[model samples]
Target chain A: MTAAATGVRATARIVARDDGRGGTSLPVLEGDGPLALRRTRGSGDEAHVMLVGAMSGPLGGDHFAVRAGVEAGARLRVGSAAATIALPGQAKGEARYDVRLTVADGAELRWLPEQLISAGGSDLRVTTHADLAATARLVLREEQVLGRVGEEPGRLVSRLVVRIEGRTLLDQELDCGPGAPGGWDGPAVLGGHRAVGQAVVVRPEFEDRPVSARVLGEGAAVVPLAGPAALVTAVAPDALRLRRVLDEALKSLG
Target chain B: MSRAALLVLADGRFPAGGHAHSGGAEAAVKAGRVTGAASLEDFCRGRLHTAGRVSAALAAAAVLGVDPVRLDAAADARTPSPALRATARKLGRQLMRAARATWPSSELDALAREFPKGAHQPVVLGLAARAAGLGALDAAYCAAYESVSGPASATVRLLSLDPFDATGVLARLAPELDLVADQAVEAARECVDAGVDALPAASAPLLEISAEAHAAWAVRLFAS
Candidate 1:
């Protein structure tokens, strides 16, 4: 599918299938620009893709959204091509992107996207909601860099809500302002950290595990990954290594 | 006259075995998901709406003698993390012992006999709250507070914060206490009327991952 025209309302739909051989594949449906799909060789048939688009010229403020819906008993591996830059808005200095996903019973969705950079005075919000049937599985990753590179830092107000069976599972509101108190400033919270990210993996397979603890560090301490069906989170400096570690860990899960 | 009793239930040192678990804070801290008091507050707030509220509501119903078996099942469905379920059972056991000592009743004894493995903490806690002459709202508030404060107070020791500062944090969180407690009471009433099986299931995936990771850790300060 060709990429959508610049400044045009655009929507991308990608459907993935479980090959029944413990592998997954994505087949692009309507899209524009460059959306490449392939399977990782000798890696238990993991689906891989790269989505690249142009933002230059009259296409400013053009919105992009992706909807991925998985069928029952299917497994999917989803990711992005490059870091998404939320360009300065025409009026508010920002752009918007939305991602919606659904996983069916006995199916799994592994969604990992690159860090999003929102320029100073930019306004952006990404909301991801997933509906899971009984026994469905999901692994979602989202990373945000609040400001531009080596410039006056910008502000990013983000809200993330996830629900299953019409019930809210995770509802997060992050407002990062300059010198916000009791926010990212204290010793036990975000502290002085600028880059923030989260990865979540859910399946009934690990239902015997407990839900409370002090510290969960095993395998690698500095990288920030968790679980038997481990998900990873890391700052920009460690993101690449964390990604590699995550890929290796996920590969081992099969 | 029972204001002292309410205070005891609300106190951070109630010894309901809360200090033994971090309510997913420890795992989040280890993962760098939460670092200090401020972030901890945010995490607590998020939970107050999700798992914390669900547990509080279920507990309120249980205290009202709504039906232990159904409440347990509903709680099991709502709690996706296996680690959390075990912790609930453990906390339930401790709460039962304390509840029996404070106010023993045949209903409590029967519920204990029916589920020797240990009832879900919320279910037992609700019963205990009712036995103590607390209303559904109070039961919900106490449950929600314990749910968050258990971890907050635990983090104080785990992160080595001053007790005074820890209590201050709790005091600051007091306003939210009423908000979530009200939500829980309303939700519990709805669930009880609808039947436990009809209760909504709300599970936080990241929190679940943290709990699973914590369970697998070789060295852990808390049992959760």
Candidate 2:
């Protein structure tokens, strides 16, 4: 089911402000676009923001640029409302998603987007660039499902770059297409698996999260970077199983 | 420009220490991914396209006079696995020794002095290419070939599959490798004016995950 090639260019931004005299949490800012931000107040200074896709999932040629900022002394929890399905449209047979995040000192951002489902004949590129302060904190999770159950997988090229004080802490990329090159089908790669997930966490307390998590997890790889930077990546047969495993890994950090 | 210099720098037996690691093939083999020659070809092909392509582009970009500092960061971003990062650094250190000895370039000496611990392997390969008067395509070919060659040689020992069969797998992949190297050089050319972000970053999550798995193994024939 191909939709007409609609050049969907959408931008969403979130800036957090510390709520003084905080008994109940309140949103600082909200807006609408192809994707929107809905603040779900948490306790104290922390607020939860769920990203809602205003329209159907992005089709081929759709471009999305999402920016998020957490002001000093404020905390934000970001989530995606639902799964994003990628279909090849007329826009050169590809779609692109880019996210930029800034975490100020004494602030925190928990970014957990729901899984992205890519159908056969789909090509997508996602790049995440994050700049952090010495005293700031960030937890980012990205999950991808190749194709629907009993369906063929699509192509995805994803990159994540995180820097602290102008120094790169974690920089990585994953490119997978059902049968494209780069060894997704090889034993060294996905081993013919269907789903892959990754998470980047930078909290003061989880310094050894990478190596420690390896001892705790089944087949996942955790890598700790300079300072508080750490990441975990894994491949599984299905989305649910991968998510469950990653959720547990994320929890183990605390 | 110096084809002979390129050959000498890119040789598998350059004694730069590529032999110590299996390029993550050890993990794959243990996971039962490469059972025979057919599977081995598929594995190399995937790497040639993804990691291999990225490495080649990084090397090419370095040869084109792009700042090594940024390219080094770009390499880090492209590589996710901790174990793989360590292996690349080790290989880079070894290559640095050999490149300095063979080429005797002050730039290589400065790089060695800057990264006393070591730099990433592909970054060194690019600098080495520049010192050797080789083109980006040459560096890309060297990096691309090395990406698969390590695994192929390691599989021969792990599976004890026929050596002739393994060599034939590489032989058949020659054309695809040429194409990948060409594409890598093309991508690097795009980054001449822009930043290194234009380079290809095709990655393999399982290759990275399994490298971590392989590193923790109490006992393994080849270092990852």
Candidate 3:
């Protein structure tokens, strides 16, 4: 659901620190506004952190950050109130946000949510770095769309890095511009389609058969009917369905 | 093209729809698993060592006139991910059609007809390489290039990484291609002189995971 459009441009930061007792405490700060935060620590070693009605406004190209740390054996569930959109700026023409997460040994982190939309002429750069131990389980989902309703695709560039014990597990850079080649060239990558999203689930080890069966069953809708390429799509009214589909698809992959 | 028998192993128009795949790059990109050009490069490199190497070796064996059935079985054993296996078969079917049109080799035609469900891409590619008069090394290099280029190209669209930068990543991988091709050719020679039972095996768990994950995405842009 869309929150009331606020004109305030403010920064919100949430820091979750492990208490060394297998539980973690979170402190949230949002633009000097009344801090409304909820922390639920589950018996299954899961720490859930939610920020509701935290920030509202055009965001005025404001900066925000979410920092999460999980000590050994503690898991964290991180999410936001709604889909974060980068509204257009008058002069600079774009917005930005940063997210950092760290998971210690035997910890798990699941970061999932709505799409990141960049309105026309809006430029956004989102960078996320996660440090995980050898046995830590991590899942992160990110969906980015350029432009608003009926507007041409905006320029968006995003970078993400996942590291295990200072060793880079994954590093990627994506830039969507007007004159790009290959993947964005219509029928090649996105098939000239708009609104692309992806989710990733990573663990230290898992059997291959179950993972394959899971992907096939969960992604049955989007599995390409022809060729070696695997692509699937469906029109949806909201982001939740899309998120569920992605989560299901990733679970299959795991 | 004859000097090296350039048989287009994974062309975008080849109906294998490999054009729609970024290998595991798409999943990696979506999961925020891949961050910069260097990491993208590593992903490509890792695939070369695992799937890429296997495909190249199989293609090289086909070029050396190894039995298609044995090569196909080896490919099946190496590709533990079902999504990948399905993709390889689809690509194999497409390659068979193209191979029939471009170069009419009865053996390839028979192999395709016999294995109507489609052989693995590497198996089909190896057979096509033999039909095109390419040596084992040339066939292996072509197979390696085709296997790696699809994802390297896909990363451009998935991440919007600079096309020039992406090309540079491929260029940097030239040495890898050579090394992999050499290894593939050697592996092919070993497989042919000995047999599938004598072939070596190596597994990369992450590549399989990424492939499975990419397969599960609901609204993915690429096929694999």
DockQ of each: 0.09, 0.56, 0.05
TM-score of each: 0.61, 0.91, 0.48
In candidate 2, which residue ranges exceed 4 Å CA deviation? A1-5, A22-30, A88-92, A204-218
| Candidates 2 and 3 compared by TM-score, better number | 2
Q: Model 3 residue B70 lDDT?
A: 73
| Tens digit of per-residue lDDT, candidate 3, span B1-224 | 37534735445455555786787788767756567687777667666655677788888888888888877866665554568778889888988888878778998988988789899988888788778777788778877887678878889998888889888988998887898889888888988878763443433444554576677667889888
Ranking by TM-score: 2, 1, 3
Deviation in Å, model 1, residue A43 alpha carbon? 9.7
Interface RMSD of structure candidate 1 (Å): 8.5
**lDDT tens readout by residue for model 2, B1-224:** 66999879877799898887888777777777778999999888887877888899998888888888788877776776667778888889999999988877777888888888788888899999889888888999999999889889988999998999989988988998899889888889888887887888777776777777888899999888
Query: What DockQ class does candidate 1 belong to?
Result: incorrect
The lDDT per prediction is: 0.62, 0.80, 0.63
Q: A39-154, model 2: which lDDT tens digit per residue?
A: 76575567888888778656678888788888777888888889888877767656888899999898888889999888888888888998998888998888888888888877
Evaluated with lDDT, which candidate comes out highest? 2
- Candidate 3, residues A23-60: lDDT per residue as tens digits? 75554433234123456554455667655545442343
Residues B102-221 of candidate 1 have per-residue lDDT tens digits of 778787788788878788888888888777777788788888788678667777877776767767767877787787777677767776677663343433435554666788879988
